[model samples]
Target: MKLAENMLFKYGSGKVIRVLYINPFTSIIYVIDMDSNRWSYPIPKDDFLTAYQNKEMIEENDDIYCRAVPEEELNELEKQKRDQAWEIVTFFKSKLSDDEHMFISKYRQKAMKETMAVFSISYNGLKNILIKYFKGSQTKCSLIPSYFRSGARGKERKAGNKKRGRPRKNGENAGVNIDENIKKVFKIGLNRYYYNTRKNSLKTTYELILKDFFVKEVIDENGVKIPVLNNVKDLPTYEQFLYWFRKSLNDGKREIIKREGTRVYQQNYRAIIGSSTQDAELGPGTLFQIDSTIFDCHLVSSFNRDIIVSRPILFLIMDVYSRLIVGFNITFESLNSYSGAMVALANSMTSKKELCKKYGIEIEDNEFPFCVPNRILSDRGELVNGYINGSIQNLGIIIQQTPAYHADYKGIIEQAFNQTNIKILPFVDGAVIGGNSKRERGEGLDYRLKSSMTIEDFTKVIIKSILFHNNHHVLSDYILEESMIENNVEKIPIRLWEHGLKYKKGQLRILPEEVIKTSLLPSQSGLITPKGLSFKKMLYASKYALENNWFQMARIKGNWKVKVCYNPTDLTDVLVFDEHGDGPFKFSLLEHLSMYSGKGESEIEQIKNFERELERTGKERELQEKMKLFTEIEDIVKEAREKTEAEKNYSKSNSRRLKGIKENQKNERLLHREKAKKEREMEVILDESIEEEDEFAMFRDWEESNDDE
Candidate 1:
């Protein structure tokens, strides 16, 4: 590929504004700022090509070729430059206004003079230096009095002047320009034929790259020359090897590398920079991030703190822009989409007043907003996918899901969780995060000995952490020129939110309370039986459902399939949607023999087992056997929740493991109570029949004695 001056190419940030310089060699290109100004330091051809994405083009030598600079980007860059120029003319010009001080034009001349003198070049170099001085961030340094940029440039220019012409290193001068080599070799290792997942580290690949050049020619028996490894001292230094090895790793960005396909990088490595919610569609109520993180602490059952339950999962929704926690749930329950999706969905729409109250955190009015975000960024959990996604979309809120296993996409909330770990969890009595240091410096710290924190206690800490993040955490704009905040405004998250809400109101949305509340509840399809509704292997018939003739009128399909919404937190009542006059009416259900909230889905399975057992035995025998079965179930769950979390059983998946342990424990106290009630009824009926027989026998005996006499 032939290269020339005035041709545009991509540099570091996919920007084509950095035009090729007036002075360029076959292997090098000079950096240029907007307005076609160039730098003394020449970028190597390989480095220029590294950043190419093939989407941009530049006109050179009457041929249209792909350039780092795209035609469309040129227009945008110029517009941006024009805006910056206006800002400089308005705000920056005032700083130079005293009559005694040099005029702005004079300062520009001085800055340009310093640049040309430092590069050891002529008037040709003067234009490039002057252009960069006014256009780049260096302008800010220039505006500061007593900040002589010339003094700093003298050292750098001397270094560049001395190294101006050495044997052209592939995109770098004689210094270890090993980046190109390492990237090339590392990519080769990424191929399935060369890359071995079972054994390959960056260090291994680094050594391999050095080995490629660490060869000496040797005479073979046939008098033909063969390349063989030289002495150990002849090998490339490890420092250079490691430096280039690390350069090959461009976190989540492998625009120039081809090795990602050899191994599934997506599952093993999280890209540091990719599809983030932090900067995307940010506003007061436009982007909300939802994620489930297990708190870095061990918690016990609220009923008993001495017994270790498990580290609870924190299902939270954070407003991406405001850093305000909208809604969350803390439980020792495993990752149920019901807890994850609904809690976040409800949190986005409803007031945090009730949520704060539940956790005993007090809040003033408007401390947090109750408006729903127009778009939510969530992981591909069961809730934001499949059927639940369609259900939530009905409320007119768009759901944007993060690609599988990409935690960076939801970094805004992940950062919030990190704050909770660093600040709040440490003070809590039983946090495991203390042991996260290298070499397990906190190995012997038995947090469980101090495991006095309950799920509710941890919940309070989370609320405080959120309040601290929103009300006190300082936020800064990445690009100050385009910040939503004015120079005079505070940068706290809550303050930013207030400002953005008042000014940057981009598609802010809020659903009606009923609509949002219903949206938050999990929906399931159920068949309306004559006995009421059959769902999850249990028969549930509400007073409203039975009274409305849901079963009789449901003969359209032989049985009507009704949409059922139930609070996972409370299974005592389910809302069976009766679409009559006033939306879906609430329904009070007759309690099933077993399936309750505490049992979770285990109750459904237990009920099925109980039914099967009853079929094997008669009703009376079944009742007696269930009394024993229920007692055993309670014992099992009681034992699990009460088990102390010792070091031996501690795991990262503590919440899930404990849930499995508890599942084995099976809480069938409801089953036991029902069985006892039926037993008592049977005893009364048996006693009354016996008494009636005794009375009839006594009357017959008395009549026979009287006749004989």
Candidate 2:
């Protein structure tokens, strides 16, 4: 039979088949014999047609060319051939064209055998196969998907026309091709074929025919199969496909393929917030607290007996809940008494802004507000309580000293202090004792007091250092606290509670006041006392308590001695009556007065001022009553004088009424009338009044004489 001639298809001699025959008819391919005798034995029609049809098919409108190599260079040439084969196979699996895909799948298998013969078999082929099955037409290079789906189309065809937003095209059929039969049938157009078969041909063919073919599996150096043998068939039959998928997900071959895109080894980590089981026993501010010891690095000051150089102590209170440090203090001397504890409490209670300013740190206020710890847990060191048992009592915070020699109880802050002293500070040269001390000495012995490189500088160092340590140090393998917050991604502790709020839901949780109270009281824990509970021979207490019981505590000397208070309920209103209840033996005014009297006599002056006002008001009342009585008597006397003058009708009285008659009218008749009337009134009234001695009597008598006639 005469065949059509086409230059594009002609290789060495014979003319190729008709253009229409160049379809996915792979059944026609064969390795032909060169001898003329083969012409008598007619070429197998299927094989001949398969070879002619697939060869004639051109993809991307490109011509096929073979690279020629010398016989001696076959090994190297074979390697290049296998690599080219892998590329072609990958491209083939990506749904480029039906005829081209079939051609590549055939040659890729051939390349695999050749590669095994001449070089190490590359697993890239197997990777390409798996990617084809799973990744599918999800990539842009998948020609079938590119032809069917437009970039301007919405994610789905049924959706309404998209507005200004960019459109999405699905890549579901990326690495799969149209089935040979489906392609042949579709050559007639979309009119007559079954829609389901047309849509799913590529996927179906990939799963059945091409799935295992291109995945060239072989043995490795360890003699283990390349694609690990997981009996996917043996997985739970209930959800076999899903089980197989998961098994395939963990398959060795998939892992090998995945490894190619990344480095050979990498660390995988996740940091999440978690609570300690021990936290259940501890209250909000209960349990062991820790801090660093700032020794008097100056050997001279430390060695000297007379001139004392105080070693600053860092006191950290750990809130067992979130394993967070709730309160802390930096001081030259330790907390050994109530006063020091109070100062530490005051420092802790100060505003976060003040802490930030003193320490030179930036903190976010929203997340990490300054924390007020309910209790302080620390080592059995006097410094922790500021060397005064009563120091921290007034602040209403409980003081708990861990057992002697048990460092693990305070491990949280202890580890922090160790890191501060050993790791972080060591990076700084002056952080060492000698170095810091000399520098500090250059400033002065009282460096912290001057606010100028003296006391202020020392104070600043501590404040800044604590800030730096708490907010900047790494706490665990994954978590770090900048200030009061934990940060995992930035890998630094947030200096303020605000930054820590991201982890708030995890770490800082709120508990009711009753829970805290219940945990603190005797029926619950019975931990506190007026003299304070005796533990390891030390006394601790809540400040307002006075009863000496298992819970009541007192500050004696420098130690916190727990004097068991008989009553726990009488914390704020403990009444200390003397031997007799009569008069209540009140420790009121004098006792209250004596405490602050030495500081300044201001209280005494206030009392004196109050008493003077009281005396002045009393005298004024007496004078007011006397003045009223005198005024009433004057009114009665004036009435009587008028009555006598009217009844007498005397010529002298009429003459006296004239103006300027006072000197001329010294009438004896008027005087006799006035005397007789006065006598008659005195007899009627019988008025025996007490003798009146008035300093104004002379002035009154002179005015009276001048007015008289």
Candidate 3:
């Protein structure tokens, strides 16, 4: 190839040389040994080219072979030396005329001596300046000082009996050198104090090393252990300790993890190399993040406004590509469960128009489209259930669960929850202010006491907030592609979503709403009885069961159980999947259990518990009443026995006592009838006298008034 100034070539002996200058008229080339900084004799151009062609000399493109030091990187002394060297080189170059042939050794030797005499420098020093100037592409940076080479860089210095560095200015003895024993102490101190979650400061760690390694403890006269420090001159200085500590850490990440916790390091210190959108190949509906958070505000029950319902769980599903909140569900479920997660997923894959309408929210038709994402990323919590994961996978949707405590994997949804809370919690009353920390006696009012909004009202508020977020909230930090920027697309989520649909290859899949709902809704086992299908202690009726006479057959043969699925938020109906592949059918609550038609699964369970408690109380009362009746019978029997014993003389024989039983019974019956008739006559006479007195009382008072008149 072409030969240029400062080009490096490797010789057969593995020696590298840099081209310095060339004489075109004389056809001679000049080069210098890069490693030794020694000049080589001039050679004819044809011989150099022949050597290069024969591979005896190979060209090297690596700049490190003969790299020049930048002038600005030099220190003050180095800068002065560079300037002096440059001035001498400039004066030497002026001695040769522009048209003169300077490749000859005779001319170079004569000019070098005159330059050395004019600059008051040695011949070798002046010659070295010229060589450096020519070797570094004839630039001023080539003359920079090489004073850094005086110190042994990247090489360990041997320790002597005397102190290694500069003497102390405080008139005190300098510390000892860091030998192998001191290095062992440093390792022990770091492992015990520095590289732990205790978070000891560096100075503190150094002090601890002094106490544990340099000092000795002994019992004093009072039997207390007292610490005694070694001589100051024998101990290593803090600077030496710090230097060795830093040098030992070749892998900084591992040391950081050791000092801090894994969670803290991963959350705050680790490098975030890629985005979820890029991971999904920038395709909309390709990846979705799902998570649940407890709403900060307490809500009231819809049926009874005075009843305070606890904080509801809010599940959010977000599209990673556009940062759009695709679907959400709000319920009074205290914890995240498979039912709540599945309900949220179902909402994500279906249209939100009807749901918004139910909450009295009107929106544009295309505001939030039905998005069935190909993959869902979530934490290893409720979504890790085998049944739910298996069912989702069967429907061709992948469920990816992140490792425990790594919420950043699903950061999109986590951020969405924070944004929603920031938008709504400030305005809502009864919202938890700090968290569930106990109030100091009477320091503050309980948030539960201030609750006023019903669950329905709270739901409506959430719906409006989500609608505003999807349509208006600006994604200020959203990264846009070139095409989107060219089209002048706004950073609003809805605009980004529309743009993605137009230009990006979407991974959205559409299945029938029923299919998705059936696949995602949580399922349970139920039994078929003569009355109806029993599920969660509530009977449900279905058309298929009635038509096939399953209940009647259960009465004759035996009860058979069937696997059914139902929504936990609404226990009004259960879905029974047909074994014959006829699809699932709905089972409504029986007419007698209409009161529980709209109750949640938790509410139904509470009702069942209350009924059990009531039955227990009734049993207790019934036992007391029965015991009272038995005590009365015992008292009557005791009285009869005592009367017989008090008579002392006579009890009639059995035959004699029974001889006139029928005649005596007839006489007693006649006496009893006459006595009852007389009592009725006496009651009638008393009623008549009272009625007559009441009827004439007004007339009697009138006659008395007339007499007075």
TM-score of 3: 0.54
Model 3: CA > 4 A from native = 1-274, 279-283, 299-309, 331-336, 351-368, 385-387, 401-406, 427-429, 452-457, 479-492, 505-507, 578-582, 614-676, 695-700
Which wins on TM-score, candidate 1 or candidate 3? 3
Best by TM-score: 3
Off by over 4 Å in 2: 1-277, 280-292, 299-310, 318-326, 334-337, 358-368, 382-400, 423-453, 477-492, 495-709
Clashing pairs in 1: 9-68, 10-68, 44-171, 57-67, 636-665, 637-665
The best candidate in terms of lDDT: 3
Per-model CA lDDT versus the true structure: 0.54, 0.36, 0.73
- Lowest summed lDDT window (length 10), candidate 1: 63-72
Give the CA lDDT, 0 to 100, for residue 508 in model 3: 43
How would you order the candidates by lDDT, starting with the best?
3, 1, 2
**Cα lDDT of model 1 by residue, 455-474, tens digit:** 55676777777777778887
What is the per-residue lDDT of model 2 for residues 324-381, given as tens digits with 9 covering 90 to 100? 4444544444344332333343334334464455346565532233333435555556
TM-score of candidate 2 to 2 decimals = 0.26
Winner by TM-score between candidate 3 and candidate 2: 3
